[model samples]
Target: MPRFHLVSDPDDPVVAPFRAIKERDLVGREGLFIAEGETVLRAFTRDAPQRVVSLLIDPKRREKLADVFAGLPEFTPIYLAEQGVLDAIAGFHLHRGILAVGRKPPAVAARDLLASLPARAMVLVLCGIANHDNMGGIYRNAAAFGADAIVLDADCCDPLYRKAIRVSVGAVLSVPTARLSRDESIADLLDATGFEGLALSPSADEILATLKPAARTAVLLGTEGPGLSPDVMARARRIGIPMANSFDSLNVATTSGIVLHHLRFLGG
Candidate 1:
């Protein structure tokens, strides 16, 4: 079991990283990230325990969380605080009373991630996806439907952002994710790997369900309002979901689930 430490003061030097976490997360935390709530904590500890740096929790729940502590590395610090002290440290009311500091793993090349996939693979390529909630939701879809990996352009939001990780229910922790460098074309690498790009667009001539699934496929999605730019869509074939009442678009995350579901069980 990891040793537990007592911390009554919010300004304690050891707790500095947890102070004003919201602001630090937005500005970037030097490769570290904050994970909140019980479910998110469980996912991190179970899937990526090596990434954990430390944890801060309310004392009242220690008994219930004994197993979680037991699973951590021997040197990992577990800090205890009363609920009020926890609130003061977080600079806001923290009802869940469970938080962890985790380190982001080093960047992996996009080609490296794609090359590791199985022969028949399905992946999601995200372009200009700046919303954390949507980023999280899409990851959840990717995990649920067995997407082999996720690739993003430089314009996408960080999937490790606290809210995005929480909203994804830790799917981001499980999925193999990588982002394209500024000059890299998402299409070139995908084509080189023999993966067909299926860009999601409302103006496309082909409806989504009508097409045959490719042996290796990448479903490309973009931001809500503007959708995919022609250049970014590149040489990919465009596909669209037919909606009732002439709705031209659906939320990107929702569209991912629909598209992935069809591709997964039906062949894509």
Candidate 2:
């Protein structure tokens, strides 16, 4: 069993890893990311434990976290600390009272991911989604909608960003996500895989509810302000969510959820 440490001060040497989480430079130096809350931390470890470096939990909550930690390798470290100490050390109070430090793993590759998905899979392709919260929300929606994979264009934000992970409630780990980086490349790949590129835009002529979902579908999304690039939109079939008001374009995440729900499960 990995021994748990009791840290009582913000200045404790043991707290360095926790403090580095918010600092990009420091996180890069240490090659670690901080996962907060019991649910997220448990999900992360359950999915990939070898990458877990250490865990910090409030002394009061140790028992509750013990069951999850029990199955982890004996080499993993679990630390227990007073609430004050954890709060000070983390540079902010972690209400969840538990946080885990883990290494960032390599991202999935688009080609490999596509090849692995089933023929009838539904994929969400984000063209330039730059918001972390939106990215996380989309991932949550993707999982809820039973999407097989998520594809990002070059301009998209990092799905593994701390805020993204938090907003996603760690659903990012549950879904397969990869970057495509180029419109042409993505179009070619979709064509080759027999997946139709269906663009989701407010300017689209066709309503989402009207069209039948394809066996292999790629729902192309764009950024909040500008939406999809013309070049990218040109290669894909245009479809829009039917709305009551003209100015009522939903947030990219909300739109994605609505579209995914309608296109993936509802269509079939």
Candidate 2 lDDT tens digits, 24-139: 53345345677788778777877777878888889899888777888678968787888888887777767888888778767767878887888788998887788888998999
Report, for every candidate in turn, its global Cα lDDT versus the true structure.
0.89, 0.80
Q: How close is each model in CA RMSD to the real structure?
A: 1.3, 2.4
| Candidate 1 lDDT tens digits, 145-242 | 98999998999999999999998998888899998988998878887788899988767899878778788899999998877777767699888777
Q: Lowest lDDT 10-mer window, candidate 1?
A: 225-234
Name the top TM-score candidate: 1
Model 2 reaches what TM-score against the true structure? Answer: 0.89
Compute each candidate's TM-score over C-alphas.
Answer: 0.96, 0.89
